[model samples]
Target: GESVGLHLPTLSVQEGDNSIINCAYSNSASDYFIWYKQESGKGPQFIIDIRSNMDKRQGQRVTVLLNKTVKHLSLQIAATQPGDSAVYFCAETPGGGGNKLTFGTGTQLKVEL
Candidate 1:
């Protein structure tokens, strides 16, 4: 399985820094991509997304870079904060049919004061 799973249950970082989250995908044919952030106990909220047609996409305070050449993707969060602490998950939509999201490994983000 090419699914991405988190190796760590939590990550603690200082505020006003940067955060980098990693994920692994399974399907080699997946085309669409998305990064979601979930608060303490809330549903994942859409942060940013990119299509297979592009290599990178940027949003306010966040940037997603895709390396189709290596079948890898990463999320970069700028200015870490206590409120920024949450679980992040990456999702991909495999090509071929209806747009369905396949989730990858999740990383727990914790911002320390």
Candidate 2:
């Protein structure tokens, strides 16, 4: 996917369908990864998280998958709804980077009715 400089990546899905959002991280040393959902004009809310030691984790209606070897992560949403339409972010905490969280360019999920 192309990063449009300051613009969030987008994933459009029909209401009641499943949605998948993707992200790539540059830090191979990142130990923890979190997925956040942000409604317009609001701070991002925690959706799910996964540790480097785990390849996959599940939450209510959501899932986080980590691919350490490829430095990639993904969020899966089941039965997407209009209320789920929002900007999603993937954040990472490097092994020794203190408490700093590095966020990827967000992905906006638009649920179409």
Candidate 3:
């Protein structure tokens, strides 16, 4: 299925501050979740991932949290910088569904000085 384009929501954060981006997924049956960062003129870059079996996962200066009860997901960026400014997207896939992902509408992260 083709994804429909929509105006992305914007999030503004101060440089050197922490930034929290949130997503609400529709599929309760999804077992895998991934967060992506997309810069202008580039494809989405994998930032982090979490499984439904886990509540949280951490990466370099980033963390992904999943709440299965509410079908909610969040990404936290520690000490956000100008380099961290981008459009963030959350994607999910059902268990054993090889390489198929359903993406949520993206949010633009703006790092303010």
On lDDT, the leading prediction is 3
**Candidate 3 weakest ten by summed lDDT:** 1-10
User: Of 1 and 2, which scores higher on lDDT?
Assistant: 2
Error of 2 at 43 (Å): 1.1
User: Model 2, which residues run further than 4 Å from truth?
Assistant: 1-8
Predict model 1's lDDT versus the native: 0.83
Candidates in order have lDDT scores of 0.83, 0.84, 0.87
The C-alpha local distance difference test score for the whole of candidate 3 amounts to: 0.87
Worst 10 residues of 2 by lDDT: 1-10
What does candidate 1's lDDT look like per residue over 2-105, in tens digits?
Answer: 56544456777889988888766767898888999988769999999999889889999899998887777888889987888889998998888897788866
Candidate 1, residue 54: Cα displacement in angstroms equals 1.3
Instruction: Report residue 61 deviation for candidate 2 (angstroms).
Output: 0.4
Residue pairs with clashing backbones, model 2: none
Across 1-113, the per-residue lDDT of candidate 2 in tens digits comes to 22212133888899999998888887778898889899999999999999899999999999888888867788899999999999998888878758878787788899999
TM-scores, one per candidate: 0.90, 0.90, 0.90
